[model samples]
Target chain A: MKPSTVPASTPSLRQSSGRYLQTKWKGLIIAVPYLWLVLFFLIPFFIVIKISLAESIIASPPFSSLLNWTEDGALQLSLLFDNYAYLWEDELYYKTYLNSIKVAFICTLICLFIGYPMAYGIVRATPTQRNILLILVILPFWTSFLLRVYAWMGILADQGTLNNLLIWFGLIDEPIRMLYTPFAVYLGIIYSYLPFMILPLYANIEKLDMNLLEAAAALGAKPLITFLTVTLPMTLPGIIAGSLLVFIPATGEYVIPDLLGGGNSFMIGKLLYSEFNNNHDWPVAAAVAVALLILLVLPMMLYQNVQARQVGVKT
Target chain B: MIHKRSRWVIAMLCFGLAFLYVPIFLLILYSFNHSKLVPIWGGFSTRWYTVLFESPEVWEAVMLSLRIALINATFATLLGTLAALAMVRFGRFKGRTLFSGMISAPLVMPEVITGLSLLLLFITLADIIGWPGARGFTTITIAHITFSMAYVAVIIQSRLIGMDQSIEEAAQDLGAKPLRVLWDITLPILAPGMLAGWLLAFTLSLDDLVIASFVTGPGSNTLPILIFSRIKLGLKPDINALATLIILTVSIGVLLAAWLMWRQEKQRMQDRKMASRTDH
Candidate 1:
């Protein structure tokens, strides 16, 4: 998006009287969000880093002091690398990290598969139909995300709707154990995030110039081939945006796995929760959060770099 | 023929939409099931709805969630609009890139990390300053505003970028001050976007569970927390009833908003047509 920084105000008016007032308003406007982010967003991350370097202790607040005042009025400070070391030493942390990534990847792929066609169809729809279809896609999204995950419990449980239907049809001798499985976790993730995928994709696809596809068709290209060559390349940005939207949150997804995944499946979000709430290891939990943030941030920064390069090329 | 491929795409779309809605439909359907055991076809009954209404805890949680959502949405919209204005109106401020990154980061930042870091911040603040005394509604609302503002910022930013600057310039040329132009011309034009951002933030805060879980104090459970805690035991009919009611409320709200937007769009189109006729 292009930035419209220079407001097109009248120069004569600005020179006469509004110059001082303009700068003052601008200062106030900038200060509000700037100060809010610094105090709430930036300061919290610094605290996270500080806590991650502190020792774990069994106490009221559960983490050891980063700074200690000695009995003789001297000050002592401690920062432990032990929490970071434990992350490397333990195999489970890596596995949890990999598992989270793997699930996130699979969920992103599933969302893309399901979301692309919905977006495509909505774009192809007549104008009124397009609005209705888009609304349908977003309707479930506005409902509670937690409740949607809970809804899957009613559908995928052993005696739930799907299993009951399967058993009634004699397709299975017993109710299939579908709930509390990785399959259900994937289902829950896809169901909850489908709108996130579709909305972005729709925004891109709806604006597609149909004349390009028609020209391809006129050049004796098959519909499938035309879509593959012409449509897919144009919507690649949408695909990436949607995938990132799904993939990022899915990586640290606690609710779906916590509610749906069985004992065998573990996620970093769950691990972080247990470390803090269950084991009272605040510093370790902080370390895990720091690690997860690192895992998420590197790829995000790389994506931003690639996007900036693409925009540069375009310009 | 291309017709066959289009048919397949249409089928896929139908199946995809069905997959999306069927689970919600079942939840709504089974809400009326009289049986205590979920998913069983007990004849239709309103027992669960009545039970849900009778529960004080649910009411308390609902009220708390609404209040947080209200406050969070309002503050997020105000701050977010200001941030968007800063990015779009003020050209090259120091830390521009950092400001933009900070604004967008929370949109994709994992809730676990945000919740944990914010919790630690609150605790540290309380320890050092002895203010905020405890983590409760105020803390949760603050946390919600911190993240939800990112979403609001993106919305208003895009809206402001798309808006025509000539109108505001016209107002300024008429000797109106900068703030007056903003109030009389810019904000009125951005009203729809601001409202949309506000509603989006409200829903997001209401739906949040993880961050609230981290920040909540004693007796401060939000509805999502209440419902999630109960899920471990087993599915309850009352929870289903609660979900159904929530879904109903949301659907109605969404439909109303859509209708209003559609009407506003029509009005804009007519206004443009009338302007063109007079020009001719």
Candidate 2:
């Protein structure tokens, strides 16, 4: 009886245990990151929404709670729309939003013009040269981004290197006022974010099949026409990816505007920071964030969709 | 392979690279200037470096940033690796779309939004759970990990996709358990990608100013925050010295990484040649 029971139970026990362990391992893998993100990344948006609806108060937390228990034991919800209403009524907010979009768009276009050719050059280089070039492209990126932006301040200042060189060349009698101006802000954004544009474009352009171009050329299509028809269409995803990478963050760029734009350039990011830090208006800041998120959701979704497609293609 | 347009492309490349590097080289050049004024060139001196070294606040900020970066990198790499595995290896799990979206969203999310939301979460958690009672190191680290891990996940996920699955399958076919196969074959192969992800996370955490500013409490200034506040008033020579040091360290690290990757690729090519030779 003992021998018979052992023989039957052993196989079943092992099989069951193996299946159980597999499921448990898989569950743990999914659960840990999932729960962490849901807790920290996702739930906080809801909180922002809640706080955006609540009134700003002079308290430790600094915002009134959305929920309150009434004296009659009824659950009462209080959500003030004043923060949003205030944003809508104010001309400054809409103008800032539009200005931010315009800056981001123009910067993205400039980055594309600069980055595309660089990416093309890298892709056309010999393998050894390509590696070095790619590394060079990424090297500045590894350095502190803020420091890179700060580096521009040294170059673009009134008495900075560029101005000094110009004056010495007798090109100008006085130092050009480049820093703390809209020009400085544009220069900084392009300088800092050009790498972002180049990388994706490089990745896309590198994958381009040379045979297609050859075929197009062989068919009597001129080089420029072939490029427009074959190359550009194929690398549109990269263009979109790089453009979004630059545009989304550039729109909300706080550092560049604060440091270089001075009092002239008003980006949504700086406005949000001043609201939260300078005015201590949590509700207003949250409202600003929500509005910014609403504006950005489309591009963000487009980016995610492109990434997913790329992954899908790979798999 | 050369085209008539190659000349134009090459010129563009030169111009673009110059644009990127010229400002940085100028900053490095000016860091040694004796003048207190940033733009003026007094005779060269290393006084700024000495001043930077002597500043206790700078030291403290550096130490804190390093600590936060270290912790953030480790935890981020772990969680990110797990997320990558779950996404790439675990086939079509529940809420996979949502999971993928959450993983990628942080990559492009505005820092202000991410920072504000995370701070709000920490506050709510503190109110409800009474943990993380004050926002400082822990809150900053948590915020860094949340975003940095998204980056790590992208890196590791690409690694996972590019990896050869047959090796792991072979290990399983040879009677190795799944966990054992992962530990022995998968993780070793993935070490380089993991290292890259870790470094990226570390750099991101160290470089963050905006998010850290939002989450950081009193007496918790990271290096970027301190540097930012100083630079906000005006450019200081000491800060330039600090920037120069950061640039130097990053260049060295990047060069080392590139060299190692090159060597590894060479080794892989030689191994493949040998394998084909043996097969012949």
Model 1, runs deviating above 4 Å: A1-21, A68-77, A302-315
Q: In model 2, which regions exceed 4 Å deviation?
A: A1-22, B1-3
Per-residue alpha-carbon lDDT of candidate 2 for residues A1-315, written as tens digits (9 for 90 to 100): 023444553344333322322555989989999999998898998999999999999997899988899999999999899999999999999899999999999999999999999999999999999999999999988899889888888888887888999999999998889888988888999999999999999988987999999999899998899989999998998999999999999999999999888878899999999998899899999999999999999999989888766654444
Error of 1 at B77 (Å): 0.9
Please state the CAPRI-style docking class of candidate 1.
medium
RMSD of each: 3.5, 7.1
Scored on chain A only, each candidate's TM-score is 0.87, 0.91
| Top-scoring candidate (DockQ) | 1
- Collision pairs in model 1: none
